[model samples]
Target: MIIDLRSDTVTKPTKGMLDAMMQAKVGDDVFSEDPTVIILEERLANMFGKDRALFFPSGTMANQTAIKLHTNPGEQVICDKYAHIYNYESGGASFNSGVSCRLLDGNQGMFTANQVLEAINPDAFYYSQTSLVEIENTTNKGGGACWNFNEILKIKEVCKSNNLGFHLDGARLWNALVAKNESTKQYGDVFDTISVCLSKGLGCPIGSVLIGDEDIMKNAIRVRKIFGGNMRQVGYLAAAGLYALDNHMERLNDDHTKAKQIGEVLSNLSYIKTVEPVETNIVIFELHEGVNEKEFVQKLQENNILIISMGSNILRMVTHLDYTNTMHEKVLEILTSLKF
Candidate 1:
């Protein structure tokens, strides 16, 4: 049995989720006629207390569409240097929106309100207009660290004062809500737009929902279509998202527990130099000098376990719905016994 701990996005649909998809009532979603897609959008919008929501094929598309909806070409978006919108989206922020990013030096992918104030470009003809502020919850490159709620509120206030649009890249927000004991409506009230992923912590095969007020969402729909995210018969995927929302959210805590268990084992190992804080389902650690990173990963793969290197000496493991109890136990046993 292969234990794929590379990412939550690697999870296959559970039997129940697949059943829901099979039974879904599908119609052409480009025409807004797919009943299941409409239901999923409404469900997410209501949960976040937003006026509307639009579904996309991936979190990247959802986020890129939101950026375009919020800003015109040549404007700047402010976010942490480690943000997915900056680092992982393959320059979609620049290519899709034609806007540059003003990156802040933040702690674990979360920038403070004060930092936002400092990063905002002065309104001048020579400077790119700082038109949007984007934040990530359970920051991916930050070892899945969650932003403090108070800090988020303070940054929202800064956005309002600066007359800048705000967006949240809440890809792993289900994990954040579980870890931080926060409410969905709180996020809805703060940001003008939010991009939430169903494939990440929620275990859906494919989908992300962008939430906003009616006007912003309508603009997002047009941007999404322009980005080639419009789909036909997408209700089958939407049904999996609905199923995941109902069944998989609460279980995210279990993945967090497994991540912590792995962290503990890593902490006790001699080869590990540092373990970034385990906040949600992602555990990231650095190896000591002289420890071959490639060799260590190969050894784990030889044992039927898989993980990913996050460049430098850092490695990452993400637990998800597909990482069963038996697999976790086996991984724990292997980790504890490893010589390197």
Candidate 2:
């Protein structure tokens, strides 16, 4: 059987999720009449202890919208060097916001409050006004690393003292919360704005939510429209998000466990130089010299085991709702049998 570990974004909606989507009550959301979308927005807002939430077609749109709301043209956003906003969003941070990023060399995608304080520009006519700070939890490029709550609180304090707007790229936040046993309200209390994805480990087909105060969300809705993200009859997708929120969250621990199991198998491989700490649901490892990434990936492809080779001789595998325990065992067996 094919074992797809490329990313959790590949998960298909389950039968129950599909059923919920089909039964969703839809309306023109732009006109503020979509019952299902309204329920989803309210439910997520309450879960996170935020004043309001706005739905977006994708996490990228949600993040971009938050950035647009938090800063104006010719401003700057400070974040980790490997953050999704800086690395994976196709330079949208600059293209859409007309702003530059001050990237910090954070550990596993987490920068400290002191880092933010130091990155802020002095009040001057020549410098771009540093107005925003962005953070990613369960950092994708950092092998699914998570931030400590106290660390986030420290950063929040710095933002508050400096009057900088704080935004969280919480695309895999559910996974982080599960891994850390943290409550959604705790995150809500710290971030000025948060972007939560429904398409990742949550198993929804599509959608994300941007949570913030009502005033901020009002601006976000307009930004969403400007970005071509406004949706009508989107309750069909929102229904899947609601279903995932109710049923798919606690199960993410299983995915995390599976990732560690894969990490264990990779650690024993002769051709693996090192395996990054398996946190949340991602396992990243570096190949030993002479193991060409392309050829190795091709070999795994031949076996119908899909994965990705990140740069620097690194390979990444993600466990998700669709990946079962049996699949994890089979992957281990396949790795154990491979020869360098």
Candidate 3:
């Protein structure tokens, strides 16, 4: 059996999700007439207690649009150094928003209120106006690490004092919420804006929703257009998002359980120096000194197991709806049998 653990983005739509998409009542979404898209956006907004939400083609566009909406040219966005906004968004903050980053060396990609306070500019003319603070929940490079809600509230207080806009890259927020047993409204209460992905752990085929006040979302819609994200008849995909929201969210715990199981197996292996905390659905670990990353990955590939080597010694595996209990067992068996 082939096991694909590269990323949660690889999940295929389930039969129920496909049925929803096929039955979707589609209309021109660019004209704001798609019923399914409207339902998905409104449902998510209500879930988070936000005034409004806008759907996008990809998480990158949703996040970049949030940054652009919150900041102006030559402004700064504060975030963890390993954040997806800074590392994976292809420099869209600089290219689209004309802003630079104030990266904090945060613990597992999460910073505290004090960290935000220290990072904000002091209104000096020499500094890039620190207008935005972006955070990624279930921080991708941090093995799906989640932020403490109290820490986030403290950071929100700091942002209020600094007049900084707080944005959440909540691509995996559902996983974080399920793992932490937190309410979605708590997140909505803290962040000025949030970008939630439907395609990741939610198991939708495509789409992301950016939630904020109506005014900010109006700006995001314009930014989405500039980023070439305007769509027509997108309800087919939005139907999938709505269906996933209704059916797939609670099951994310299954993915988290699978990840911890994998981590447990890897922790006992001789070649795995350490496994990062399995807080949610991602498992990241460092290889022992003698094991070459390429060779390790090649060995797994030979066994029909796929994963990504983040660096010379680091490997990453993400579990989602597509990965089953059998797949996890097979991966553990292969890891247990591998020789240094």
User: How many pairs of residues collide in each model?
Assistant: 0, 0, 0
Clashing pairs in model 3? none
Best-performing candidate as measured by lDDT: 1
Over the stretch 81-128, how does candidate 2's per-residue lDDT look in tens digits?
999998889999899999999999988788887888889999999999
| Clashing residue pairs for model 1 | none
Clashing pairs in 2: none
TM value for model 3: 0.99
Q: For candidate 1, which ten residues in a row score worst on lDDT?
A: 215-224
Candidate 2 Cα deviation (angstroms), residue 48? 1.4
If both were scored by lDDT, which would come out higher, candidate 1 or candidate 3? 1
Worst 10 residues of 3 by lDDT: 214-223
Q: Report the Cα lDDT for residue 338, model 3.
A: 96
Query: In angstroms, how far off is 330's CA in candidate 2?
Result: 1.2
Per-residue CA lDDT of model 3 for 206-258, tens digit only, reads: 88999998877777778889899999999999999988988998999999988
lDDT of each: 0.93, 0.92, 0.92
